[model samples]
Target: MARNLSTNTGSQAVGGRRHTVGRLVHYLLASPWRVIVMVLAGMTAVAMIVIGPKVMGEATNVLFEGLLGSMLVKMGAKPGTSKQAVVTYLQSRGQDKFARMIDSMNVQVGVGIDWGRFGTILMFVIGIYLISILVRLVQNFLMTRLVSDAVYTMRRQIEDKLDRLPLQYFDRTPRGEVMSRTTNDIDNISGTLQQILGELLFSVFSIIGAFIMMLTISPLLTLIAFIIIPVMALCAGVILKKTQPQFTRQWIRTGQVNSHVEEMFSGHMVVRAFGHQGKAEEEFEERNQELYQASFKASFFSALVTPMSTFFGNLSFVIVVIIGGVHVLNGSMSLGGLQAFTQYTRQASQPIGQLASMGTMLQSSLASCRRVFDFLDEAEEVPDIEHPDHLGQETGGKVEGHVRFDHVRFSYDPAEPLIKDLSIEAKPGQTIAIVGPTGAGKTTLVNLLMRFYEIQGGRITIDGVDTSRVTRHDLRSHFGMVLQDTWLFDGTVRDNLLYGLDEGQTIPEQTMIDGAKATHVDEFIRKLPQGYDTVLNEDSSELSQGERQLMTICRAFLSDPDILILDEATSSVDTRTELLVQQAMNTLRKGRTSFVIAHRLSTIRDADLILVVNHGSVVEQGTHDQLLERGGAYASLYNSQFTKGEED
Candidate 1:
């Protein structure tokens, strides 16, 4: 029912992180214009930041000079300080370096700190930071929107990719892993980006701005600081690199834990029925333990960044103080310059630590990114042949359902072939029933017919056109399926019945009533509180297996498919429900080509042709009477069921 609704409307994962950079680049490069504007704004903000410390240092220099000059006036120096007099006084006291620096001072011996100059410097600093803040705000706002959009589109792409992946992917991969990539991982990417977006900009620009400020203040101090900074970064980088593998393992283990939990929940009833609760719990505990280890390692390594950063920042601070103090005493550079240089060292190391620490979140996000990208990069199903619609056009918008498998071959594993050189033909409007033991590839045959799994070799054609030539959509448009495991969308009974209808396509109420009545489901459906409008979803207490099966058959009836596949549809229901739908099933099959895979030999006794399949190849093929006369595999299968029936 769910599939038909989609019809009406509409790879294995490789290495986890392969081509991650390339794919990320592709996503970003697609939006170069927006990126350029954000980058420019960020750079402007950084410039203002780097300039603030310099202006602040100038204010400190002015204040210090004023304090010294007022003291000199108090000691009875003249109103206007003479540089020569101060130099002579200092030299006599053996303070040659301080005397030399006094030669360049603009201080008046009698005056105090110039409040106007200090206030102007303060305003300049404020203006610089204000501009930086404004630019930063604009950049962050735009960046958040842009990243959100990219992740949004990434989700859509993953969704579309899900549609194109082959059935084998889902068969091989656990449901929780698939869900992790689609929901959890992608969400992690979005969340991590949001959390660090501002910090990422601030850390990077602060490091750059601080380094430039330090160089302008004291190149020698800047040199010593730069050496210590890289060592700090290097240690952080090394530890952070270790975190990547840990984080990768963490997420992988998370997927495992989710898979185990989801599986246990989905089959909890069966687990309890079989009394396997202890085993399930044990398995979950094991997976949880693995996840705990990985998470602990990632977090532990990531946490080291802060203390390591602090340690290096302090070491650099001490070195700068000693070296810069010497330069200050020599009067080669002012005390204010050394003070500014000290501030720059702090800023640089702090941001460097932040940037290094980000690797933790960044690595975790990248781990999630690798999973998502790996999913997106999975090998897609083979593309449909060009001009797929040409076949439909040739068929006059109708398919007669003449399907043939010509020497087809297939295998789940290449080393061990399953269906080898099997050939079959079903003329238009023929009912072909397939009987097979378990693991005999019975469902696989029909799956091949529907192009669910492409044949490893040979060609399957419908109405003399290659099935591979048409798009799966156009090909499947001609067919409808009812499997043993019936499915319905989480919607109303009416919704499930009309699932495969096109966007606005609708059936007349009478037409629906007639289809339901034909399937003998009308009475049961009408008995429901809401009748056909009843909601059918997970935990559908109102629905039963028999009701679900009947509804799927009704859905197939509504699809009006030229070809139909009923795989054990009647095998599971109670005898009474089977009998009710049997007449409707007969009517539905009339004049349509159908393939029925059934274990109940009695059910397919009247098929136009029956193929007895064992170990993936047909052991016998003939009508009921002919196969019975031969007394081979078919006769053995029939006799066992018949004897079982008589004994019952």
Candidate 2:
């Protein structure tokens, strides 16, 4: 069932389209002007190439008429279309008559060539060159901007989605794979889009114009060009059919490499302690080699395309020349006309090669699209419901500090229930301690209360209001949490503390200092040279473990939550720090309902109610003294801890 759900999620994210070149093109075309400019520029350039040669041919014919025939006719001699007539007239004409003809013809036919036609063709060629360059420049600029914007927007969306994704999703998807999608995969897609659109789009336009020009110049040559199309198509199809799967495999290998590297970095302490440097290197090399092989195969097939297309292009050129030569010798074609036809053939072949090369780009982009959409489509763990009733005035003035869980059952995986049929109630201004063996779902209970994970079986009510009906943001914001690990962003202590405060609430220096004192954190803050304004380093190594915990606790106090949960808040601190923290916890718990999870046993001795949980069930419940007197699980637990403490 989980597998089925994941599959459905993947489909939904990517819109369930098969990853293919065509689809990749669709994504690129998402920025319409980039594609439009490239296509139009290319089309116009080709049109210029085709028409330029024809215009030049016309200019050549005009030159021959003016120089050889028209001049002779003006000099008192007959101008004939036939070669024999011209020869006869030349042989019979006297020197004076020839001079007169030259004089008269010079006036009638000044300069044989059509200068206007020649000039116009030259200008069109120049104009086409300028337009092509301009279009290319614009296309490149826009495509760069577009691809950058697309990747930036995409990464931002994925980051936002990651922030919202359920904690369980992180357990299944590796950090490295997610990182690769944002960085490496995005880079690859960007490169492909730019290269394909910039170079290949232009090549395609040139080929189209060349083909049409060839057809108009000589139908026989155009027919010869058609023969090579099938060959180019077959080659592209065969290469693509083999490379598409290889490209997908390549991306998977990339993910594997990334995952391994990230794991090595995050678990360096464990790896070093175990002395597994050699083992880690060996594993990394294996993954790296797999990536290399897949990448090589994908690239090798892509590389074959241009050469194959060129071979067909050259072969077609050979055929066009041979057929055209025969027509020329048979007096059916001109020298200039044949020259233009050959140029057109070369031009026509280029687009086919470009279109063929586009195959590899398609495969790569399709894979990236699939990955990107997969992230976008993943189920949001907690959704901010539309028009959710605000918990504002409904809480009836500052929450009343009452919370109830009615037969709440939840499972990370349905097959294995983590918290089953659990029910509890906490009165206003009460401190409730939850004690259990590790994995007794202690943290899971807190998770449910915070609405981080929804309960599958029963409803949790806060101030007699069902939590499901309220906005998760408002629900969580009303509570404060200080966990075993303190999360300190790269900022000043004051900034981190201020993060918890509500908008428009000015944090006074005395108020900030008092909140820190309540958590017993002010001592450390005072010792720092910059006090509250001291900036945390990237590693946050400047502060001790206990100091960090105190800072987080102070954050909670400053927020003044109606309810609080401290999950092993003192677990990492030393004995001296624990005493300080315990004092802070006691002071902060006043007039507020609190849920405390502690391993030390001593921290929660004063809890108004002690609930002993074992194997996801509440086995014992009462005040600390009452549970100890009953001599059940709580009594046994306290005794064990006391014995261990005495031995220490």
Candidate 3:
């Protein structure tokens, strides 16, 4: 369960929270058509929002004027009072400012609350608001599609980049780190875009629309609204500066935490076998604590933006209210106009707050974007040659499998050479047993042959065709490898064995049966509840070690590659199973050029050529019997292995 995708759950993901600019620009540039449509929709919505407040304000004006007229008549003011008469009376009382507001309204005292006119204004206000809602829905829908498409393409690019990267990248990097970048980091990018992009677009337009509305109704109040803008900007700038790095560190820590958890849980059996569970837990706690600190600092600082914006917005609202109220009483502004201005004040301020609050998600999103882009921009494996030699083309498509390493020079680290000036030749169908002590470049030899690492000097050729001249896929296709560490995936037994087949190609049922019977696993397979259909868990937990090794060997047999590279293929099995596997391997090697990296001397006693390797060079080479008779390096290694086995 600890390895269930991530160490953290969905909520835990929330807890952890670029090339940055160039990559984002590129990502957005990838979808110009959708973005253009979204922009258009956004403008339409903002237009409706801007118009709705004004229309509603007019409705307020109609209602207020009708009510005022009815009240004046009730107070025994003259019915059907002339507009000019009303203004002249207010002027005479030194209420000259109030006279202007009355002159602007069509308030005839005898008209008394014109219900038909008020109803018309109310209907228009409703229609205006309904249009705003519809336009916003369209904008929201477009935004959702754009985010989905961007992340979808991002995931695909990451996957392709992984496939093109050199094997050394994987060797040096943690599996969980790679997976975290591909999944959690990409998922984080998706979430941030969804949570932030739509709101960001809407907020920008809202601020613009509201500001325009405020200016149209009252410039003095509009000026007061934006007085708080610089304060909000300065505070947001300070908060954003602190939160960005924390977000970056938080995601990096999340990856580290995931790597530790994945490694421990995937190898939990080994940890238990070695009794190191406490050490694992201690390491995990240390990494987890680091992640918590990073996530907390990021979220804490980002949380400041909201409250800061709210304070400024409220301050702006209060100032606008006091000033606008005076204007209304002075008759320079209508009650309806003041009402609209206040709504616009809040509208503009709220979006500024929203923009500030968005800083948290924006920083988190930028961090994820940079990580993804970094991965995408990694040094890829050297591209395959433009005009590569098809490895078997020189041999009439029936490769002779005469592999030769010609004075090869190589190193894992440039200064620390692992293999130097090594040369060896295997004739067609010859079994060349490579015998060496630990770290004597035995596995390194096979890795070079497979082009896992290219040689710095000299050439490796398969059937006289230089391997470097051919594509890796073409070069490796001729070889079937069964290394000491047998690997199987979560798949059916049948699928595992046939994994090496080309797409849409499958082995004959009879071929599978014969190979299983020859490898002495036929009875074992038949005894299983579902035979080959039985699904395997990680590393084929249901099978014994010997059974798993046999399954891998069986897989190599199914591949029927031209050359076989066996790294003590039967080493995991018991003596009886080893003998049975040896017989099958002997039969398997008859016409196939085999390179056996042998540890046990008995396994290679019948090899056509036995090369004794020590300190990155071949110290002795001969037929197995000749080496023993000559009492050279080969003889010493052979005698030592049997002696060690007997002592054990």
Which prediction has the highest TM-score against the true structure? 3
Q: Between prediction 2 and prediction 3, which has the larger TM-score? A: 3
Tens digits of per-residue lDDT, candidate 2, 1-648, equal 999998898676345445434445555567787667756655665565567666655545445435645565565544333444444545465444333333322222333455676677677667766775676676667667666766667678778998888877787999999888777787887777767765675676676667677777777678878877986898798898788768878988898899999999878989999999999999999999999999999999999998998899899889888988777555466656777787777777877887888867767876776777777889987576666655546546478778899998888888887777889999989999999899888888888888878889999988887888888877887898999978888898898887788787777889988888777888878788898889986457888877787788889988888899999998878898788778888888999999999887888889999888887878899998899789999888889889855735
Which model, 1 or 2, shows the larger TM-score?
1
lDDT of each: 0.84, 0.77, 0.85
Superior candidate under lDDT, 1 versus 2: 1
The segments of candidate 2 whose C-alpha lies over 4 angstroms from its true place after superposition are 1-42, 49-120, 141-149, 198-203, 382-387, 395-397, 502-506, 520-531, 644-648
Off by over 4 Å in 3: 1-18, 644-648
Q: Which stretches of candidate 1 lie above 4 Å from their native place?
A: 1-19, 93-101, 389-395, 527-529, 644-648
lDDT of 3 by residue, 1-648 (tens): 767656556435444332465667667667788888888888888888778778778878878888878876785668888878888887888887778878777788866666787788778877877887888788788888888888888988887897789878889999888888899999998888888887898889989999888888888878888987998899998899799889999999999999998999888999999999999999999999999999999999999898899888889989988999888888788899988888888888888888888877889888888788778988987788999888778566778888898999998898888788999999999999999888999888998898887789999998888989888888888889998998999988899888877679887899998988988878898888899899988867679988999999998988888999999898999988888899999998989999999888888889999988887889889998799889888878777667755734
* Residue pairs whose backbone atoms clash in candidate 1: 4-500, 5-499, 5-500, 8-500
For lDDT, the strongest prediction is 3
Cα RMSD (angstroms) for every candidate in the order listed: 7.1, 6.3, 6.0
**Cα lDDT for residue 79, model 1?**
76
N/CA/C clash count, model 1: 4
